[model samples]
Target: MGQKINPLGFRLGTTQSHHSFWFAKPKDFPAELQEDERIRDSIKNYVQKNLMKVSSDFEGIIRIEIHKYKELNTTQVKIDFGRQNLLTREEEEEKDDKEEKKKLELLKTKAKIIIQLIPEPYEEPHILAEYIALQLKNRIPLGKAMQKVIELMEETDIKGIRIQIAGCIGGKERAHVQWIREGRLPLQTIRAKIKYCSYKVQTPHGVLGIKIWMFVDFVDEEFVDFVDEEFVDEEFVDEE
Candidate 1:
């Protein structure tokens, strides 16, 4: 049972750190936690809506870090939002287009969003996860979808990769789990650097869950992810 814990949680103090950075009083914790979920969902929708437009160069979000301020009563979401420049150029282009803007804007009414954009070269895990989710959304078969992902990863020089899918696969009346793995994954090694992502894809059948784990190189290169924190794209969205 202990071994069944999430890999990130297992190595939190060792190789990984918290994605959300916030402190809340016991009385205020639940509301803040739900706010965090809403923020993540909004970001996910933004990525899905805009991915095809910029798929040529834009990469998937590697991770999201949320910092909440009690004094300011605001939350700042930092993601690899893959803004090679701005958080979303699509958002910029849609300015004259208010209908789409109204549809795509973050759902929060009170919290101002300060999007900090930084270029992240690490696209191993979330990219694949998004690929699988997209495939499922298009009604692709599970086996074929999983196969295509393996083929795509073969071109990369990563150490290893593992993918897991669950929840009503292939439009079945029952739900089950399936997975595919290739190369070598040193999951038990404490020093092994791995990129992980869990994603949910909605379909006509039901919602499917996907988890991807990609083993990056060892920690010798000094953990090459979100290296520069100076670059920021602060967008002040008008409260609706």
Candidate 2:
């Protein structure tokens, strides 16, 4: 006769063993004693004895559920890339506009001093013109030059002072020294022929003339520096 299978649910196999068995109880199994440990032990002992009755379908379900749980836990989230480039362009335009405004204000605050060359006997015209241009090129502004002259003129008590250029000989070379002076002219169209004099110094390149003029007012000295510093450009510098 075949051995009878235990129908009560049971688990078999040692904790380290790979193969195990699960069995369901028969309908005639005792109801009141179902949860008793003695009853459970009897079921486990019988299932191990009749191991061929354990189901393969239960093991397959458990394996599929474990893989599904792992897939849900490992997924990643997404971001947008063009926002940095727009911010950089805005900063560059603001810097360029500030530099242009500063240059414009500097040009508005200066006056012009016109120095005409009068040809004199015994001097080459170009020599005198070149000499005068060199002397003024790097000399400290006329304000300082005027102060020194004022002190010299006072010592001599020279009134109605006139500057005599020993060799003022230039055919058409005209030099203008401009600056910002304090007083306004009585009329905008007034023109006067103010006579001035200077000494000529010869250099390796050419002759240089230093023209001297008497200032009726010290304010004219300041006006000239302001104008030259602002309106004069590279072409004027090149003319020298």
Candidate 3:
């Protein structure tokens, strides 16, 4: 009657929803299904290339969403980037960000594509998974990576946090699972507002998989919404 399942999928109507919104004809469904993969890969590669050009640390992509409208002949791609900063002075960092925006505008015109870049909030599941992926890529021990990220998340207002990493952890020959947790993660409670994401990273030794489940308390949810609105408002208010 019961089996292992994704928390988001299990509670779809209550708390989780699809990031992409589009429909395809049955004949075109197979090709359209693979389109998301292509979009994600292209954006990932483009972001990495841009980072290398700027010599900046990977800021991590939290999610990429696609929406197509056949009647309008339009496709919309939105990307949410994690909260990672460049190693520089405040003024230079702001300048770099402005320059990146300018470049994106140029890209939109040249590529005939509409892409919206969004900044992900602190300690989201995909953002955490990306942080751990970078640490793993750098050959950091799994425990240290989990502990470091968890310690940071502890300062936030999350109700609970859990992380799992599997496959050749610590560069061992055999694959194993390692996990770390802080506070309560009520999988049985559909109202708990849990966000989950699974990510895979390729290391020199082997491939490692990471899963993060974040329980966010709804008490602060209003403040969270306000922050997003404020951020969006700033762009228009401050833009010349």
lDDT of 3 by residue, 180-223 (tens): 89999998877668888898888898898999999885432222
Q: lDDT, candidate 1, residue 178? A: 98
State the C-alpha lDDT per candidate: 0.66, 0.27, 0.66
Ten-residue region with minimum lDDT total, candidate 3: 222-231
List the candidate 2 regions with Cα displacement exceeding 4 Å: 1-138, 162-174, 177-197, 201-208, 213-240
Clash counts for all predictions: 0, 23, 0
lDDT comparison, 2 vs 3, better candidate: 3
Candidate 1: C-alpha lDDT = 0.66
TM-score of each: 0.67, 0.18, 0.72
Off by over 4 Å in 3: 52-59, 84-121, 218-240
Candidate 1 structure quality by residue, lDDT tens digits, 1-240: 665657787666556777777788999889878877877776666665665466532346667777655555455556654444444566644522432343235433334333434344334677677777877877888889889888877777687889999998887899999999988888887677777878888888899899988887666543334323542323432221
In Å, residue 57's CA in model 2 sits off its true spot by: 99
